[model samples]
Target: MPEPITQTEYWNGDVGARWAAMQAELDQVFAPLTAALLDGAGLRPGERVLDIGCGCGETALLAAARTGPGGTVTAVDVSRPMLERARARPAGGSPIAWIEADAQTHPFAPEHDVALSRFGVMFFEESRTAFANVRRALRPGGRLVVLCWRALAENAWVHVPRDAVLTVLPEPAPSPPGGPGPFRFADGEALVDLLGQAGFTGAAVAPIDHPVAIGADAEAAARFAATVGPIAGLLREIEDPALRERALAAMRQAMPAERPVRLGAACWLATAVHPG
Candidate 1:
């Protein structure tokens, strides 16, 4: 039997704090992506939506707006810090519920018309079971749409920090495969397979491009990429302070020296519907 993959403690520890801070600072960068995600989900009036892995409720809040006065939106995440920040968003008169819970195990009410995630749903240790649980939360014909990185080759969220990670850290300090981590769904074929295995039928994977404004300047952007991304965790694992400092320096240099620096992000819109 294989050992089950689990969430990294680093995400909830000091790393999570820095990640939260970075999220707050770059909240604007995520807004347009969230809008695009929900819009693609074909949001409608009086619909009940679930925002899975909804880091800070960005998509959930948008769902609330799309659903108008009579609809409800629920956003869930495992990160308490993320949820706290999400709760602090200025309340609108629409119904939006925020919960801190693991998506893999949380019970769903089977009343939702749609489920969505933006740059979320990529960290499941066991995607088959995790998605099965998500499938259970929806009505017979309920649908799901998510924004996940298409591959490491295409997204700076990986490549930028990866460039710094390889330089700063020694070779082959490899984290375990099948371990609970982000971008696990980066493989388009595998993601579809998992959804099919989870009882979802007729899925489509679509390419999505959005402008990501990393920071106002190169420095803030560098810090943001270094602290909250996949590369940052690897960088943090290094033992030498000198190497760490060098990594940060390289990240700063890697960033373009421009005001309101914009980077194009590539993601996949994986959408599916439940068979009635």
Candidate 2:
């Protein structure tokens, strides 16, 4: 069998392309969560910021606006497609450097006032080492703020459709323990402990729950769920077109009747301080 694909390869492949194409829609769906993360970050004008896993540059652009023209933003991601999409967008705030590099090992200048991620951070192959690298990039007492999914069960926007699809396909094998995946840090205590291990201080996590519209209708919602997020990952492995269609149908049938199907999203707003 071929060697397993690395996270860099995974994101740079078709997954990245899909995300690049759906950037606007994904941003709209997660707008509330983005707001919560930015508010929690408390970015100030002229504060240099490091945006980790800055896919399509939504958080980075918004952060730039908050920090204004005097500030600078280093937005890093492994996916070239997403970075290209981000670079193509209209930017009106601080200067942003959209670098197609892995944040886990990037040699970021040690001058940022804050490090931020929106649904990033969780994909690190070495979670502790990655955060430690981020910590090293921050100045004394610099803050790290991120939004990560809380748990599969807690996130109805994912699990509801996931369960629906699973009815048609077998459950995929569980990810390796403490492995890199969306819900890797679902346990708040475990996440805080990892931050402490990475030499961060005063680590804290708070739940930020909100209703996110997945699509305009059941069909749209089904397509949205099957085209992106965790469910998309699951469907990507299936080679049989007929079976895949069945799974999509299940997802459509599972959606609520609301004109714009909305589902609850649960996430943790984790924050930490870098020791000088």
Candidate 3:
């Protein structure tokens, strides 16, 4: 068998292109969670900010707006396609520097006032080392806020459609324990402990629950579900065309018989401070 791809290659390859193509839709789908992350960040005017895994530039653009013209935004991601898409988009407020590099090991200037990530920060190969690098990028007393999925079971926005798809296809192999994935930080306590161990102070995690509308209708919602996130990743691995269609049908049928398919998304709003 061929060697498994690294996170950098995984994101910069086809997955990155797919995400870039769906950037606008994904932004809309994740708007609420983005708001929660930005709120937790508490970005101030003229405060420099760093955005990790700044996919398609949503959070970074928003952070730039919050920080205004006097501030600067450094948006970093490993995916070149996503970074290109982000760079192409129009931005307002602070100037943005889009850097295509691994945030896990980037040598960021230690002068940022805040660092933030939305649905990011969970894919690092070494969580402790990655967070330690992030901590090193902050100025004294700088804040770090991140949003990560709490658990697969608690996220109806994913599992609901995922269950439907699974009805037609077999479940994919589980990721290795403590491996990088969306739910890598499901255990809030462990995450906080890891943050502390990474040399951050005042580490804490709080639950943030919100309902997300994937689409205006069931069909649309199912399409959106089957095109992004974990379900999308699962579907991509299947080579059988017939099996793929069946799985897509199941996703559509699993949607609630309602106009707007809104589902619960449970995440952890984790925060830490750079002790300088």
Candidate 4:
């Protein structure tokens, strides 16, 4: 089957390239959330783990460490560019298998003891089907842990830059409520219900708050804001180069002068179990 059209284009094109180039910086920005996700997974030695949306393999490497030499990690993602970067990194003796495939339709063995993701599970066009497939990949009673953004309003790192960009370009229409996107699963009750429908039991979603460091200073942060993620996506739509620079300048003005520009962000640390 073919990949999801929208994501296949975005991730394989500019978005994927930008992420690959900024992998280290992005990883550092989200490091605390990664640590929380790994801690919540409670992985033990000798367990088989599946890391969905494993960009650049950071979480997969961490999982491999927690699972020890006897365990294994299969890291899957849809972007070839991201997977290329992931494969380029040294494994440091950790057992990991990197696969480029969409989690929604990929053929997965029902052999994994745990499945986890960090800010990676949200982009599914059909989340219910995607999560059901994830459940199918796990052994009986295997666990699922995912971290997802809470809401656009709750994530200053995103909304602030996004707003600044809008000052110079047309604002894109908002995604439908509960639709596929970063904040699609923001509501805890909605997520729990969706997981229940996808054959997961004991579903729970917990709120996690953290201050994310976007860059070392306002200028750096503004540059990153204009060149990455949602803000960048918006900027890309503008045909005028001057307008794009205007957006960048607006972002710079909006950002604080303090070093290591930090923004308050919130996400849901969700977990569920496959029934035996």
Candidate 5:
């Protein structure tokens, strides 16, 4: 993975706190989608599941309920501030074990039955290596499932705001034609291929057009974006003061009054069985 440009600032600074709070808001916007991201996890009554980059613990908490009393769920993330919110969450079931480690290189046990990531695998500088680490963390018969964006054009939530932010900032690191944006795993085929290279088979991707319900006002939404999510930081690079204001202003106006705006976001709901 590309070395984090600002590891310390990104991980433990105000940006982190802003993001945690921002995620809290955005997750609420994505609550419904969260349920579907976990649609087929098959979190049986007594099985274990690992939620990688388990943002805000939404899916992790859901998996915990599925596991019931005999089962366990371990949720891991790279951010302490984010995990703090997860850890401090009111008791829903068994307290989820929260681990603060890079999902790419954490020393993970290989006994878990399933490994899952929801909109969390895209930040890696090196996708192959990250998945390789995740593969090593799973048992021989385990499965890996992930949900990522489809393409930039498919979703206004991403591209629209991205267009707004980038206009305000300096050009970012070059991204792929259709991907490597914040939502790198947008291509299901690409994910399947990568998983195969990482030594897993039966990788499959399913499309999910989740209508996101954003905040009631544009300013609220922009605050959420500029502070916590990826767009704001990207916009910070814009040296042209007028362009920056216009871009951010555009994002605010982009907010939809109707909840669940039918913005197309491809959720590559993929699962690959570990080769025994």
Candidate 6:
């Protein structure tokens, strides 16, 4: 496995476990983005699909449904714990093959007609190499449709909570500008450049802005902010109980009064074709 050790350790450990536990909540919150990605995939009744970074398998299951019984979907991710959760879900007649492997170097069969991901392609240690590998997994003229964050500044769901936490604790050192993280592909041109370098042709990146559900209520949203995603990771680093509680309170205070608080988020819906 040539994956970055830090990412592997983080996802396969407590973070992954936490995500698995909160899979339902996470899925519901990000349902719109998932829908958008699937909508753009243009899946047919019998087209083979490859789902990268399949998390808890929501996207894979949905893709399977579109592919119908005659088609197949191969869903891959690095987190075994997540894969366990995915496997535990009812299949609902979707033919999905869940594999716990790093997509960057995994020996995928070269048969898929489409490759799809939702916020999954950003974490590759080497974007070009990983995408090249993805391209190789597809038959000629296969399509790639992915959804990735546009920019941290444009995503209130992410930056707002982290900012709240930072009021109580020092901001952690930033990762490399285009490093392996959620915001790695935030720049649309950079993403297009990466795909082009990876042997993909006619790469197009478009903005997909939507309102994402945070929680059923403000309180629940606050709790989610403190217990999941990047803010949660930051909270773990704060050893002082008093400080952590203060940070949590700050985040909680920032949530809106609306039920299922809808926050604006921006992502790039990138599309490309594998050249013949």
Per-prediction TM-score to the true structure, in the order listed: 0.90, 0.98, 0.97, 0.95, 0.84, 0.96
lDDT of 5 at 21: 69
User: Model 1 off-target regions past 4 Å?
Assistant: 1-5, 8-10, 238-240
The total of clashing pairs for model 1 equals 0
On TM-score, the leading prediction is 2
Residue 82, model 5: lDDT of 79
Where does model 4 exceed 4 Å of error?
A: 1-4
- Candidate 6 lDDT over 67-186, as tens digits, reads 888899999999889999999998854488999899999999989999999888998888899999999999999999999998888988888778887887888988777678888887
**C-alpha local distance difference test of each model:** 0.77, 0.94, 0.92, 0.88, 0.72, 0.88
Report the C-alpha lDDT of model 3 over 58-132, residue by residue, as the tens digit.
999999999999999999999999999999999999999999888888899899999899987998999999999
Error of 4 at 202 (Å): 0.6
lDDT of 2 by residue, 32-98 (tens): 9999999999999999999999999999999999999999999999999999999999997899999
Q: Across residues 1-276, which tens digit of lDDT does each residue of candidate 5 receive?
A: 775453324656766676676666767777666777677666677777888888667788888887777777889887788788777776465447889878778888887888887777876656788888888887888888877777667776666677766654555776555333456776677778988998888888877777665545677666556654457667666778887678778777666665433344546678888887
Q: When superposed on Cα atoms, how far off is each prediction in RMSD?
A: 2.7, 0.9, 1.0, 2.4, 3.3, 2.3
In candidate 4, what residue range of length 10 has the lowest lDDT sum?
2-11
Q: After superposition, how far is residue 94 of candidate 1 from its true place, in Å?
A: 2.8
Q: Cα deviation in Å at residue 53, candidate 5? A: 1.4
Check candidate 4 and list the clashing pairs: 216-260
User: In model 4, what is the error at residue 100, expressed in angstroms?
Assistant: 1.3
Q: Count the backbone clashes (under 3 Å) in each candidate.
A: 0, 0, 0, 1, 8, 1
Candidate 4 lDDT over 1-276, as tens digits, reads: 984458767788878888999999988999999998999999999999999999888999889888988999999998889899999987843489999899999989999999999988888888999999999999999999999999889999989888887787777887676556777877889999999999999999999999989989888988787777667767777788887778888998888767889987899999999997
Of 1 and 2, the candidate ahead on lDDT is 2
Put down candidate 1 lDDT per residue, 1-276, tens digits, no spaces.
Answer: 976434645446676567576666656876677667877899888999989887766677778888888888888887877778788887563598898788888887888899888766877767889888888888989999988876666777457757765676665565676555566666788888889999999987888877688788878777777776677667767788987888788777777666876676788889999886
Off by over 4 Å in 2: none
